[model samples]
Target: MISSPERGGTVSTPTLRQILRDQLAPADPRILCGHDRLDVPVRWVHSSEIYEIGPLLTGGELLLTTGLGLRGLDGGTRKHYVHDLAERGVAAVAFEVGRTFDEVPDEMVRAGSAARLPIIELRSVVPFIDVCRAVNTSIAAREVDELRMRALLDDALHDDLAAGAGVAPMLGHLADLLDAPVVLVTAAGALVSAHGVDDDSAAWRVVDRAVAEVPVRSRGRSLARLVVGERAGAPTVPYAEALLRAAAGPVSVGLTRAGVRGSALAARLVEDLVDGRPLRRADLETRLAGAGVTVGGPSVLVPLAAEAPDPRMADAAVAAAAFDSMARSIVDATVYALVSVPVGGPGDVDPVERVASGLARSTGLGRTTIVVGDPVGIDRSRPGADASRTLTDSLRRCARQLGLAASAVSPAGAGRRVHTAREMLVDEAIGTLEPSVRAELSALAAPLAAHDERASTELVRTLAVHLAHGCSATRSAEVLHIGRQSLYQRLERIRVVLGFDPTEPSVYASMMVALRSLAAGA
Candidate 1:
């Protein structure tokens, strides 16, 4: 996997022949070698009279010297100089003749010829600075042109992807453009998408022998890499490294699109899974496994509900990436995540809580409530239909929790939080009571509601808020955007109408049940 020297090697720049022909040099230099081989790119023009300049150059430079180092040097030293410059990939050596020798040194020319290095003899005095200025300006112009070309290419690739062309097709197109087999592998070396490589093994072999590898990254995360040079006989791709680097943006966009599509499909499957009508066990197992949801295991489903335009998953594409391989779907404002929990695995923490926290942090979702249901273990030995019935019941529980999560989640300010349905068991129990019992409980808040309706007061809201804050007047005031005195005034009104103080610990449980029961019906 010998990577190319520079990632930006595809840029078109001024070459030695172009520099000489563009009248960038003065006093017509004599070519000591055949001028046909002058295509070496001149990255910069450096005027170094030191003989030890070989170690100083990073390569791809056109060296301009006045024969200062060649003075009193033998043939062996001169030959060493020629070979060093060639090894450094110096475009060409232009030696100014007047300062050190009357005629160009014969041994220098012969040594350059042996090394297949281009040598230019400036017979008349030449101003190294003037030549450098002209050459470097052209170099800058060519660089600008190359950058413009890369931008145009990237834009075209992005447009094609946005039009629904997938990553594989784009990679194939890139392989054609670069004239090499290309591959993209994950950080774990799994093949993500590729083109021109024969098969999976061949693709990995291409990775093993990568001639150029460009990292594909987005949103400050590295997702994968592009590997070129698939086979020994493949024509060398022009600017292979530069083209791969340019393609990184479009690659990330393509991968994001793919992830979002998978999430969207998973969401559809989840909707079906949660529906009242059960899918056959075979059909359910196939879909669940495809989405990375383990079948025949203890399953815990967590439903995350938020208001429309949830800040956490604003970009469904990013949400898809953040969830990794989890089976999650964004249905309306709620995200349903189906998790497979190992028996007695890890600590008491649920996987959904850990994942939801990360998802919230990554999406900048200020608040999220994930109501987790009891884990249901599917008996694989049972009939397929029976097993699917068990899962369907669990999913139904999941569906109900989504609604409960909305009504049950308490007012918690701005950070990652996870709440389970068990925490709201009393509320759930009250809501499920027989209609007659439910009616009696709902009556508890009727007085406050009636006062609110008649006077346009927020007595009912204040009661709920106060109860949600554990009967703390100070915290309720802060949440209600009121002063302590104003909150106390509302509390007094609530106490007068309801015939009991909501702050009494003896009646707190009854008050909570009444409020939650009313909210559940609402």
Candidate 2:
């Protein structure tokens, strides 16, 4: 039997054509059938007389045997044997004629032709051991060549790392080696770096095909994914998998270093603005311009809140870089950006919404809240001026709204109501009502709160559900997953505890406001 290299390494056995054309084997090996499949690779060589050998194969085998096992077998049995070998993906069947039958069986030839399984006839002069030796020698030569190529690739990557070259050079080198496009992306699918490709190309079709994705990790956490597209006339599958595995480590190191440096720069800039530090207008403008943001004219402050924290800000950075906006993380779960709206631009095109949509698509954060503030000029000379203060206040208010939205089971109902600048400002003002007024509102729900705390009852939730369903017992019961009798009993208990008329309009309005105020942490 031919000895093959270990699986999942940069080595592959020779194909069927190589074995026939090379001088290592006997001079006149003949293909009896299925000549079209001469290029299939021969993974191994096996010799067996057992007819039930289909269960023993792992595919891509060149099987050799004599006709001893098929001496008394009928025509149907002979055809069945060849069909079984074909179904098991045996690369080719080589039979020696002198051992049993005078010539090859016609039934076996027709079955091999039908299944497209290459059938080769070996003359009496060539021993079976010679065939095995030739195949093994070819596999050994392939392994040696793979070792040399792998060394060259490793040295190239080492040189890049030593020279402080960034991710682009690494990816470009990898693309040249594979002869196909390569892309690096965050876990959320934001593009980090790409080489030898464009956004619109047929190579992107490989993203949805049998893609080879390798994870890039740092400090025990995954930072990004390296994707290698399929190349035409590439090596075997195991060799490709090994190559990707080799490339992932250095790519991860480069990405992590670059990400840390970028995050530090962005954090300092954002922290200064949030804390209202004094700075020259020219300096601010220069920094913003470097990031592709034009802040000389009118600009709007856009605050974005995510349901979870993205520590590296990789997704947001990609989105911001794409739209030529300035983005920085203000908190663990919130980021703020400034986007320019051209003067005399069409009113119908809302730049804030466009930025928000782009970020949502990139970050894959479905419940993100994007709040837009009124336009303010960056030319204001004084630190903590009215314009800067307003922008900062709007950011804080937007952050509060995000927290409120995340706590609710369904944020789409009330969270979506705070869209415009005026609505956000009004909500902020209303949220800061006098302590005495808040206390007065709190008294409206004191009874239900006490009962819920003491008896572990759902009185507050029941009241909210009842009010939400327009005080309809039937509808509320369905929503609460309780029977009609149980819902009525709970409503009667609520009325008794509050000492109020159950159907009074004035009482209902007061209780609704009190519930909202308590939920808002008033």
Candidate 3:
């Protein structure tokens, strides 16, 4: 953070009404339109005689002009000029009329009203340079006052720290000082604590739309970020930002002294979700914050659950690697982790693969299986219950696949221990079927099973191989070491007994699952 000359207080931006009420306002000013919006703050003062100067502006400028460019313009052109200025977010337009026109144009006034832009008519012959100087000087003075106020506030917060105040109390004090909701979110965007916020979702909303945000760091690593809202009732965002920046030093110092251990808390959070335990929104937010895993504001969560002879290998892998945000907890003999990666970042890097490799390496030359469930996309705008439900449901789904992924972890060899739930997604889905549903699917292949048992014909095996090779008669015959004509004959007899063509796409899919389910049950 840039060093401030002093610590905590705030000065509001100078508005047009405030300026007009004082001697800094231009002489002989008359409100032509938009009188109700005089509270708009002036960022800077600019004087332009060129008619097409709107595009050159960068919003919030108080445009001053002697009307030299509006002389004899057509009605449409004058309206367009007014519209251009308004659309560019100029705070207000001060038009001097004696040199170019007797009064402000009716077309311009109507356009200003239509755009909700303030138009001030200068009836006297006022020099544009003097007006710019006086207004700019006032703006600069207010900025200095704002900085001084922020320094005072910062100092007060340090005093709070000296008085044995914790982070939560300091947040409350900050909220009282600013008269707004204040929150602390981890760098990953998880809520640590909040003041003036009602619940978990509201805290996230504050983070999502925070007008002022400052990072608090210890020894060059981020500890947390301080957020302030615009609803302070009086403090502008600029002033709030200045105060927060100054406050970060004390916040960092406090966090270091408090010894915030994020990794352990994060790990516990991931385990709880997978254990099918319901967690409150506040509890969830706090734990996720501790783990440095963010589920808010465009953050996507990927849950990975693993078991191994030694879970420390997996723990070491995550601990040693450079993941932006990851939390690991060893629950029983299994380690559960929730990794956060940004959306629309490097799409080529598969998170599942990245985490799988880490786990595989951590348990090198040992028995370990890692299963990454479906990627859960968190919508921060949802209600607290809805967000919490989404997280719990996703993790539970991942938990259900643990048994299956574990069974198939060493498909290639014992060395190939890491696998994604997606590799067996179809089977994972099949495993979720109700017991009666699975029985019905298994029954579909019962006739073949019986035929093979009674006649010793190997029909079930024939059908399994045939469908597994996409109904390729030649490949089926080669694999079964049977005559081509015999394979065809058996396939025809099997179709007749099954009462449907097995090669049809939908029937093929059903039969494939049925055969697998039948084999699994057996």
Candidate 4:
């Protein structure tokens, strides 16, 4: 048996050339087999002990011997030996001629080859150690070449990151490097930008929406996502999604660098503007444009300020790594930072308020209220004046809704915007209100909801749904597949218990919202 550090164990089935290479010069050509370069590492053995350790040997280990090892063996016995060795994961068999049975054994060769094991006979004298050394040297050189390539890649990345480059230039550069197109998206799945020209909106939307949410806190920021384009004719969407997600890291950083330069400068300037306290949008735009980001689009500017749950970078690093792996697996974008903070500035309703409230409820942060400003659209091409004003106005509004210290953005907002706290919660609240009322009504309706002896409860539900959909008796009758008079009678019974006329528009709206909210809460 030979011990291999790579396998972390002793291998019983050995390769002849590898054993020779380990103990001798690894530069000799005598190790060549079938006119092909012998590249596999292995150890040699001439003893019958090969059978005992065969099962433990992973394939690719060469075996060496002469006829003396199997002298006097019958055809059946020899075939069995060769078969057993092959079954044990032996890579090849080498027979040294001129020792104990000179001519090649047809049975052994046939059996070994049938097992896909390369069996060779030495035609002339050759030093085994020279063969081993040759293979070892070649392998060492190959490893060195691989290491050099890896080093070159690392060096390039280090240089790109050193100067605070953005994700766009980096994406464009990578696309150039890979000869492919790249795109960056917001977590909510909006396309931030793309490198190439093939516009498959469907594919883009699918990938963008499927990406993981980057946990972040950006005031009034929409969620951002990252997407990578697949090569033409790619058959699998899932695999393609994963590939793009894996590529998002570098792409995200690239776009961020390209987009934030102006924003960062503008941010500093804004601090100054607010300090003296007379803000001119144009001045801010000029400063922002100088930093290279256009502030004119219908983009909302969201200031990110959230204290991390764990102050140590260690937790952040772990989350980043997890997010990276998840991005690779799910083609989703993610962020590693706190996404909540105190509201500042004019009475601005911090959008993150909703997310915080939900998270707080889910995580026990406490009762929270949030306010949000309407979305401000930014034209991508003219990304200066309009964007800056929109952002400023939105921030001011956000400050008002969320209490002074209760407002904040997600940490991930450094890159992009997601839904604000109010939008998310209002939507949540709207969804659950009505369903809950109906369920409470369900107990009242249990005798009624379940009382179908005359199908009165079902008729009532149908009447309600129809009235909820449209108060027309004709429409309700058509929908319920019943006569108009039967619907009227059901409505009367519903009114008796539910205590509201379905025809009253105001009453209907309240009932609808209540039912919808109740359902949503469920």
Q: Kindly give the number of clashing pairs for every candidate.
A: 0, 0, 13, 95
Q: lDDT tens digits, residues 493-521, model 1?
A: 88999998877898887777776666666
Best by TM-score: 2
lDDT of each candidate versus the true structure: 0.65, 0.63, 0.70, 0.43
Q: Model 2: how far is 80 from its true place, Å?
A: 3.2
User: What tens digits encode model 4's per-residue C-alpha lDDT throughout 365-387?
Assistant: 22222233353333445544454
Model 3 alpha-carbon miss at residue 522, Å: 55
Q: After superposition, how far is residue 119 of candidate 4 from its true place, in Å?
A: 22
Clashing pairs in 2: none
| lDDT score, candidate 1 | 0.65
lDDT of 2 by residue, 1-522 (tens): 111133233445678888777632563667899899999988777778888888899899988887778888999999999999898999999887777877789889999999999888766556667778778776777767556556666777778778767567877766666556677755533345677676624434555553477887765656567777766555234355555667778776665443322345555655456556645666766665665556765564454433232323433443433555555543322455455555445664565565555554554333344444545456555555555455566555554554444334221134342243433443345468897887787788778878999999988778877886789888888877899999888989998998985457877767766766665556
Quality of model 4 by C-alpha lDDT: 0.43
User: Residue 141's C-alpha lDDT in candidate 3?
Assistant: 76
Q: lDDT value for candidate 2? A: 0.63
Provide the lowest-lDDT 10-residue window in model 3.
406-415
TM-score, cand. 2: 0.42
Task: Kindly give the stretch of ten consecutive residues in candidate 1 with the minimal lDDT sum.
Answer: 305-314
